[model samples]
Target: GYIVTHVDRATKYLMAQKIESKTAEAFNKATLSMFMPLAPSKRLTLTLDNGKEFSLFNKIENRLKIDIYFADPYCSWQRGTNENTNGLIRRYFPKKTDFSTITDNELQKVVHKINSRPRKSLDYQTPKEAFSLENMSGALGT
Candidate 1:
């Protein structure tokens, strides 16, 4: 299982989903599909860790038409946004818990909570507020 989060840089909005999968290819497909409604453009650059779980990067790049960048091995700080998101997810799903027990609906609730929470980085704006469709669409047009 893997968790995916997409942040709209211009509006600072975040969309996250937890995927149930045993392989990297499945994760990539699920992530791409979830992000399609956002109208992804070349501005989408994914930065990921060098975990073996991300071996399907080529497939993801080809399918989504988005470039993927890898962080330096052993340097988690390079992907701080993801690292922070993983930490937040831990509140609901602690390490060592069986992910198979979590349902898609339960995972969606968790994603909602995270996106609705205010963040200091976004000037105390919830990701939902900062990255609402209205805000993002307006910014993209300008």
Candidate 2:
């Protein structure tokens, strides 16, 4: 099993869901389920790591009307926001933990805690707060 993580660049708002695999189809489905309800303008772009799981990036771009850019090979810093998100998740589940056994409710609890935690980057505002501000001000994009 695998888990897919998505972070809103401007807001630092994050979402993760456990999946049975990292196939393109699965990734697309998960992305849609997680983002479809949000205003399309809020999702202006996706900076993805170089991974086979994102082979279907076009589908996501087309479906969500968002640009998709890939990070340079071996350059994790390009996706620093996502790396930081992964660190937060690691604190809860750690490495080597079996995600297949984790329930949806359990995953949501962790997601909630992370979104509620304050961050210095946003002047100590929680991701949820930053996201709300972005939406309110129509500042989700560059």
Best by TM-score: 2
Whole-structure CA lDDT of model 2: 0.86
Q: Which candidate is the best by lDDT?
A: 2
Model 2 per-residue lDDT at 80: 88
Worst 10 residues of 1 by lDDT: 133-142
User: Model 1: runs farther than 4 Å from truth?
Assistant: 5-14, 133-142
Tens digits of lDDT, candidate 1, 1-142: 6666665554445566666764686667776776566565424677777777689888877876777889899898876666777788889999987777888798888888888898888788887887765454553310
lDDT of 1 at 82: 66
C-alpha lDDT score of every prediction, in listed order: 0.70, 0.86
Candidate 1 Cα deviation (angstroms), residue 26: 1.2
The RMSD (Cα, Å) of candidate 1 is 3.3
Give the per-residue lDDT digits (tens) of candidate 2, residues 1-142. Answer: 8888888877789888888987989988998888888888777878888788899899999988988899999999999888989899989999999999889889889999999999998999999999998887884641
